[model samples]
Target chain A: MKKYLSIIVVSLFVLSSGIAFAYDGSLIDDTSYTGTITKIDRGARVIELTTKFEKTPKTWKLNMQDECQIQVMTTKDPSERGAFKKFAELKEGTLVNVYGWPKDGKWLARKISILNPDDYMVKRLEADAKAGVFFGHEP
Target chain B: MNKKGFLALILAVLFLAGTAEARKTEITPADQRDWQVIAPQDSDTPLRDYAMLYEAGGHDGNIGVIGIPSMKPYRYIKMGVDMHNFPFSGSNAGNNNGTPDGKYLWVSDKGADAVIELNLQTGFAERILANPKPFGIHHSAAMSPNGKYIFLTGELSGKMAKMRVADGATTVIDVPPAPSAPDYPDASKDGKYVFSGNYYHSAVMVFSQDPFKFIKEIPVGKNPHGTNFLPTNRWAVVCDKLSATQSVIDVRQLKVHRVIPVGAGPLHNQPDNFGKYNYISSFVSDSTCKVDLGRMQMVDEFPIHYRVGHNSIAPDNHYYVSQNKFSTGLFNPTGIVFAINFEEQDIDELSPTYGKTVKIVPINGEPHEGRQIFSTTIQRWNTGTGGDLFAKGYELGDVKVNFDEKVPGKGLTKRPSLEPIHLAAAKRYFIPRDDGKPGVTQEGDVTVVRVKAFSYGYIPRFIHVKKGAKVRIILTNIDKAAGLTKNPDVTMGFLPAGYYGQKTRLDGVRGMSAVGEFVADMAGEFEFYCQQFCGPLHLEMRGTFFVDPPGGTASLSVGDYDEISKLEYQVSDPSEREFITGGNRLLNTLKEGNEPAL
Candidate 1:
């Protein structure tokens, strides 16, 4: 009975340690996922995201870090970022790419890049359609 | 007593009548006549005796004669006889240079490829000699000092011809082929030799005045474009466009004696009346350099706002008039003439501050080569050589242009209806988005986009819309300067096809805006670009206009639409996943390596 209890306690300790190490803010091994921001909570410094990769479109909670980097990416112009901002700046319907570690069934955000904050994607899509590339034909 | 007195009165009346008849028959010999007294007065003079006339034509194909006073300080009067049958139609006036004889003015007509002699009184042109081949582009004409022959330089043919004034017989001499872009031809004071500058050859070709014989090719500097002979100084100054040097050749020896450095792209050099200083005009630097003949060095330089072309000093030596050729761009062919005051008695004379005293005269047309119309020979026809009269003002009427009033495309029925678009220009960029949002995506709505044209490129270089959509584009120029310190004038041109023609153009002045409207009716990809030579990378400033078919539903996504997979799709290719993962690793490594060592 003592040996069995000791084994179970050891196993639990190892699993918790693995979970904590995954969210230790090691950006080198961080996972990247692109999604749309569905909701934001300035009080809790958290955001609700929906990704195209998942069926049923579950709203996943993502926690922000004190050093989290938020950037705006441009197609040809240089990417602009590095200014300090609050969680309120990230609005709903904003397309973003999140880079962080998964912890406790949620993502701990290391960086979030706004891919089309100016809605350039809409223009680009229109251009593609005019070029017939969206319809899989040559213009 | 009454009979005797009547007889005496009759004899007295007969004697008076005989004396009057004798005075009427008295004639002066041609050799002893005071020809200067018969010379025409300066056009600017309130009271003038004779009128000096030459053929004047505009770029819009209007040809006529302009008359001015033959005396100093010449001014323009009304247009003289009009030439209804003048040949050749182009942007230039076709008449490049003109020389006035006592009764007729000989003009080198580049467009007609012929030498036309115009009757000064009637203003009608008659072909004195015609080129066997077309497009000779005759540049300048120099009359022999003895007035026996007129030497003309054929710019395109690289040949020089001596046409006999009396018989209209021409003797052509072909210079060596490589450097044969000959420009100005000037004769020696003794009328023994003629010298022409071979523009591409960087040399001066000498020919005998009488027979048009190629005497020798005297090498000078790179791209010798202009040659002028200063009779008082006995020196021939040749301006080299490429080397920025003046080859001062000794006329007696027919060789270059010294090379004096001048401003960049020194094109034409003219001497003051006393030959004290030679004024050199540079095309690339937009400045004029004054070279002291006695010192054989550049003594002073003055900035002329536009590119300096041919220049001439006033006969009184008080000031000089220079022609300015603006840069080649859309709707910028017309240039201005500037009179720079160089009065030596002024307190700020010949100093840099003296440029403030300059006067600008606006002119309609492209005026390049010009000269003051006063000549001792021309004055000799009026009175004796010692008469107190000097010819002053130039006849730039030989090169004039009237702006074409017709819009680029007036009768095209297939023209598209253009809406209004606005653009903003920055240094090296043209931002097309006005509201800080992406371009319009809707198909049926009016497409109004604004764009800014500046130094390097246009922002949002790509645009798309449905076919038959009306497009309006407004452009602004915000570039501080074009090159080092020159202000920029931007021109935006569009081409539905691949060639340049009657397309839409939006021209904007510095800190100003211009508007253009067109229809994106063509269902294809077209390019719009800067029309002017704005900067080094001006050709690369272009944007795409994409027109799609109606009713096609295109997905609007941040990334590539085709690459985006469905929600249920899983990563099937392991190599694809590896490539993406590896690319990110490489990017992180590079980003870390590029960081400064703190």
Candidate 2:
């Protein structure tokens, strides 16, 4: 019975250790490159990598047309359920530094520094239009 | 069938046919109620259907709501770009503005040094936040819970940010380093805890409150970049690019708990909404590892979605993974995003072993009253890139009723005095068209046909009205924000596909107003459509309208479309042969939009 219990415990430990320890080792500076932004409307919400390369330094308009993705990793209030909702309420000009690859015209953000965005506004945001066409309702 | 069986079928069909026929000709629900004065149906064309010339600056202004069937359906995606202040006022947009809660997209104009609000639903600007601190505001913004605030990060300015609606002012959370990092700061709840992994400083900093007073700075792996918190809010997974290590921190304890070595390092680490899991992505092998929270280990690894620039999930638990951007032909575009579902691994819905596949059927011509169904490029699939319609089918001027191999037919022979019987139809398909423009393409099988009411989305909510009440409506396909359309013309409104999705003032002091057709003359229920393809539920868009007679109930078969059209022509200028030609053309268009060979 003692031996069986030991075997069962050992198997549980093995099964639970599904996570592999990842110690990222990059001596090289991944400061910059170029790629397209896969998802753009993060506002100040950053993602991990840029998705495309337009191959230029000119300022690209970040809209739904442009692909941009930003990853955000931060501690929570331990209570709030919707983080995106919190991100949406941020004031303009909350600043941050960004390190990324630039391909074509857009940038695939590699690294970002959250800052005071007082002077900064959401880059490319617009309201959508819809027509309320239904039964028995008037324009 | 058999004689009695056939007769029974015919009787049932006829009864159902009577119900169906009555649906089109019956007076609107609002016109049938007691103490309600239902307006008479005018013989003249609807105000929205007629072209008008105005005096804009007294220079003969012309803005006409062109005539297209008001009763068909369409789909589209509309992004907002404020063209209201553009050099050409009328040329830049489709007219009208929207609220911040309405715009579902984000874009940064590096040139104007401004971050404007764009409408992905109609390709128009609802609002604009101008004169950014740095002349180079790129695409960056994050929303807090309940859409109260937004966070904007920029490279030119060195301040960690919060975007509040009041005064559009900025309250500095932290002083970020120069050249501003390429990424944006993601907020926890209520912008309480904002974070930025300063690559220059080689550390990740956590903030507290709105102004962002630093609580503690953790010395993470080299280039402590790409950080995210598990949905559980228990751990903060920081991806350090230099050491190829994911430094895990116990956010609650605010301490460096452990460091995990990810082979080839991680380009990104993502947390699920539940925050119980995190995905570490590797750009090199194009693979990802699923991290287990309990054991602090990598459990499973899978190939990336594509050249995998980034990935996300919809609220419905569907994954939207984007691939590399396009470069002519040699390269696939970043605009190519895929709808993937890996965790829902059961491939048995209808057939135990067969999984569901994406269907892209085209529109085949159908004949209605007089409308002619023609195969046009407008029926192609439309999305953001303008032209990526890989499917085809027969769609119409209104409802996107696309047929598969079989065309649906009906017993159109009219009759009276039959009891009302409803027909149950098998689910079919429709490919909606949004005026076939460059930016809008209404996709899928859901189609909205114009009824004399104001409504959209699924048909769960209804607006009851009285019969014979005059109502005007402007129908537009709205599928962009809902991710259902891919039409350029419909999205951009180059032709006749633009619309304003709103209900007329229910209690206004104009001709007549009420919350809905609540004062219905007759008592009955009616189906409504969102008309625009907002998403999978777009097809289910419908509503009910009740009209009660003077202390009576709504009966079957009132003066509906079939009856009204017949009555309308009687008052028309039948004396002129040319009038008949014009009427014939209109009738042909209607017939073509509906009838199909059985």
Query: What digit string (tens of lDDT, one per residue) describes model 2 on residues B1-598?
Result: 7799989999999999999999987876655552233442211123331111100000000111111112111221121211111111100000010011111233332222233343222333333343322222222344442233344544333345444321233443334445334233444431245565655555776766344355656778876645655432345677776576778876656667778877344545555333324556543344555664444666556553222222222211112121211112332322212221111111111222122211111111100001011112122234553221112222222112221211011112211111101011111122232232222112332122232222124212433334543322222333333232221211111000000001111111112211221112223333233322122222223433333334444322331323322321211133321211111123222221121110
| Best by the lDDT measure | 1
* TM-scores, one per candidate: 0.40, 0.33
lDDT of 2 by residue, A10-122 (tens): 98887666332221111112222222333335554443333111111222222211111121212122122111223333333433223332234443332222322121111
Docking class of 1: incorrect
Taking all chains together, the TM-score of candidate 1 against the true structure is 0.40
In candidate 1, stretches whose alpha carbon ends up further than 4 angstroms from where it belongs are A1-139, B1-102, B119-128, B177-179, B327-356, B374-598
Candidate 1 lDDT by residue in tens digits, A1-139 = 9999999999999998887554311121123444589888878889887752222233567787543545442222221221223455668898765644454555666456565434333333335335432210000
* lDDT value, candidate 1, whole model: 0.47
Which regions of candidate 2 are displaced past 4 Å? A1-139, B1-113, B120-123, B135-139, B172-182, B214-216, B263-265, B318-322, B325-598
Evaluate residue B491 in candidate 1 and report its C-alpha lDDT on the 0 to 100 scale.
37
